[model samples]
Target: MKKVYTAIDDFKKQGLDMEIPLKLLMFTGLRNHSLSLLKVGDINWIEEIIVYNAGIDNSKHKVQFLPIPPGLMAALKRYIEENNLKFNDNLCYGIKGIPLQNKQLNRITDKICWDIVNQRTFNFI
Candidate 1:
């Protein structure tokens, strides 16, 4: 049988760029606002988890540990190391290198573009 992560296969096929969060959304059911709050430091490499610490100013749903599969965790580790990302850096950055916002995440969905033989250009989201 297919698994929860299997739902993200389509998004993975699209590439591992800015669109990756869409796959995470499907897996975690995390609201865009919550995901946006994530920072590089929130990730706990030893625990294999992503920590989301909700500030007092924010509403409920404070503090969470989202597990990362071994393979994906490895990928994240590599990306972080190769990019020389720091703890204060933002975890999610869009194609234009801007912090990913809720509106932008909402727009992250299946998109079809009219290029060569109806190529699916996901740039719309």
Candidate 2:
């Protein structure tokens, strides 16, 4: 597996929004499943925190809070603004207003990282 630095560089080369999700995943250590379920309201813009309200069916424990690092917060804010995301919008989405499944999110994210590494090395090779 390539290191994160290489992955990030490749992602940057690939360009635009490619690195944001990766950054979020890396910073929060959130499982793809949990991350997909996040809504805009889950983020406290003023406090710069993400509140994971794990419902009874989904959560093993209970509500959890993760501090939004400055970088992550900035990225998220940019993403929201760029996408013109509503305040009540779900953070992750799929086609035609469909929500992304956890499995799908995992697949996409994994492929992104994998492609980043492969492409970076490919350029040098």
Candidate 3:
């Protein structure tokens, strides 16, 4: 967990993009495919959970829910408000505000994976 947090801080220090999605993936254990399927509509604010509402076709999970930590939920709220994201908008977007691609997720994860596997200080992208 410390490593994950450290990795996030490292990303931030580097001025890298996609920091939120990378941190979310680290905390949620959501793979690239699942991350790609997420949208603003999937966040069930009333229940305080991130609903896997991508449906069977778009999601690997069987319509489950992941509890949203207060910090993460707050971040999501701020991000949404700042970007004026609609319910249908992608939860994670690129520089152009488009949905992130699998390659992007892979690139982010590869950095973390290398650190975890090699027990090193950095695996920067």
User: Tens digit of lDDT per residue, candidate 2, span 1-125?
Assistant: 25655555654565523455556677777887777778878899888888987786654667878888897799788878888888677786542335556766576566655666566342211
- Order the numbered candidates by lDDT, best leading: 3, 2, 1
Clashing pairs in 2: none
Better of 1 and 3 by TM-score: 3
Which of 1 and 2 is the better model by TM-score?
Answer: 2
The parts of candidate 3 lying over 4 Å away from their true place are: 57-61, 94-97, 115-125
- Expressed as tens digits, the lDDT of each residue in 76-125 for candidate 1 is 77767766778988777654557778877755542321222354333333
TM-score of each: 0.68, 0.70, 0.77
Residue 48 in model 1: shift from native, Å? 0.4
Which parts of model 2 have CA positions greater than 4 angstroms off? 1-16, 57-59, 93-99, 112-125
- Using lDDT as the yardstick, the better of models 1 and 2 is 2
C-alpha RMSD for every candidate: 5.4, 4.5, 3.2
**Whole-model lDDT per candidate:** 0.62, 0.66, 0.76
Tell me the deviation in Å of residue 51 in model 1: 1.2
Clashing pairs in 1: none
Model 3 C-alpha lDDT per residue in residues 38-123, reported as the tens digit of each score = 88998989888887754556544477678878888888899899888899888986433468888877766777878878988753
Query: After TM-score superposition, what is the CA distance of residue 61 in candidate 2 from its true location, in Å?
Result: 2.7
Best by TM-score: 3
